[model samples]
Target: MRLALGVQYDGRPFRGWQSQREGGTVQDELERALSTFAQMPLKTVVAGRTDTGVHGLGQVVHLDTELERTEFSWVRGTNAFLPQAIAVQWARPMPEPFHARFSAFERTYFYVLHVSPVRSAMLAGQAGWVHTPLELDAMRQAAACLIGTHDFSAFRSSQCQAKTPLKHVHQIDIRQHGNFIHFRFRANAFLHHMVRNLMGCLIAVGRGRYPVEWLAEVLESRERRLAAPTFMPDGLYLAQVRYPEIFPVPAATLTSVPWSAVWSDPASSS
Candidate 1:
C-alpha cells in the first residue's frame, strides 16, 4: 500500500531534508521513526528537498508499505516515535499510482522578514531580520514583474540540477506588518535558491538600491551574477503543495488562524 503523509518541521537543527554523512536530517529522522513501527526498513520520497535551516508547513511525502494500518493509527503512531522538531500531522491512504514527488502540480513558498534593527530571540530560528526598514510598496511593485512564465536563469542557484531554466510563476505577493514583510511565491516548480534569489533582488528594490524595472532586465539577461546575494534560509518556508484533486482544499467554511498556529490547531488550519 502507498500512503501520503503531511509533515511539518523546524529545520534549524537538522542539516537538510536529504540525508548527509555527518549530521541529522529530516529524511533520516522520518525513516528511523517509521522503521521502529514497521520493524522493517522504510523509505519515503518527499515532494521536494529543502535546504538546511528552511522550514516547512505543508510538506508531503509518500511511503511504500506492505503492512496495513489505519490512517488514524498511523498518524498517532508516527508522531509518537518522531521528535518534537518534526511531526506527522496527517496521513491518508493513497492510490497505488499516486506519488508524492511526481504527482505534485505546484509548490508555494513564503519568506518572513522582520526588518527591524533589534533582533528577536523568539524568532531566532524562524525569521530573518534586516537592520534597515524595507519599502513595502516598492517590493510589491517589483514582485509583480515575476508573474508569468519566464527563463529564470538569474534566480537559479549555481548548483541547481534542473535540466531547464524555464518555469511558470503563478503569483508573487508582498505584504507587510509593522516592520515585518512577507514574501510569498507560487510556481509550477522552483529551481534551487530561486525564491531566495528573487527575494534578494526585491529587497534591493525596497532599499532604493535598484528600480522595479531592473527586474525585467535581469530576467531577460538570464545572468546569475546580475542578481543580488541570495537571502537567508531562516526566513524561507515551504508553505504548501498542490496535488491534483485528491488533496485539494475543499470548499468549506474556514477560519482565520495565524500561520504560526497551524501545528496547534490542525482542524481549523488544515
Candidate 2:
C-alpha cells in the first residue's frame, strides 16, 4: 500500500531533512522509526528538502509498504519510536500514482524575525533575530518585484540542483505583529536557499541599507552576488504544500508559532 503522511519537526535537533550516511538528519530518524514500526525496511519520499535548522510545519511524505495498518495506527506506531522533535501528524493511503514531491503544485513558506534590543532566549533557534525594527512597507515594496514568474538565479544558492532557475512566485506578504515580522512566500517551487536569499535582500531594504528600486536591478541582473547574503535558517518554516484536488492531504496546523494566527494574507500589491 502507498501512504502519505503529514509531518512536523523542530529543525534545531537534526541536520536537515535528507538522509545522510552519518545519520543525523530528520529523514534518517524518521525512516528508522518507521522501519521499526513496519517490522520491515521502508523508505520515504519527501515534498521538499529543507536545510539544517529550518523547521517543517506541513511537510508531506509518501512511503510504500506491504503491511496493512490504519491511519491512526501508523501515526501512533511510527511516533512511538520517533524522537520528540519529529512527528507524523496524520496519515492516509494514497493511489500508486501519487507522488509527494512531484505532485505538489505550490508551496508556502514563512519566515519570522524578532526585532528587539534584547535577544530572546526562548526564540533563540526558532526565529531569526534582528536588533532593528524592519520597515514593513519598504520591505513590501521591495518584495513586490519578486512576484510573478522570473529567473530567480540571483536568489538561488550555488549548490541548488533545480533544473532551471525560473520559478513563479505567486505572492509575497510581509506583516508585522508587535516586534515580530512574518514573511509569507508562496510559489510553484523554490530553489535551494532561495527564500533566505530573498529575505536577506528584503531585510537590507527594510533596514535602510538600500533603495527599494535596487531590488529590481538585482532581479534583472540574475547574479547571485548582487543580492543580499543568504539569511539565517532558524526562522524559515515550510508552512504548507499544495497539491491537486485529486489528492486529499490534511490541512496541517501551525500550533508552535503563536504569531502565526495574527498574520493576515494581504491581497497581491506592489
Highest TM-score: which candidate? 2
lDDT of 1 at 178: 64
The lDDT, on a scale of 0 to 1, for candidate 2 is: 0.92
- TM-score for each of the candidates: 0.91, 0.97
Q: Give the TM-score of candidate 2.
A: 0.97
How large is the C-alpha RMSD of every model relative to the true structure? 3.8, 2.0
**Per-residue alpha-carbon lDDT of model 1 for 84-151, expressed as tens digits?**
99888778888787888788878888788888778989888788888898778888888777889999
CA deviation > 4 Å runs, candidate 2: 264-270
lDDT of 2 by residue, 31-146 (tens): 99999999999999999999999999999999999899989999999999999999999999998899999999999999999999989999977999999877889999988999
At residue 169, candidate 1 shows an lDDT of 94
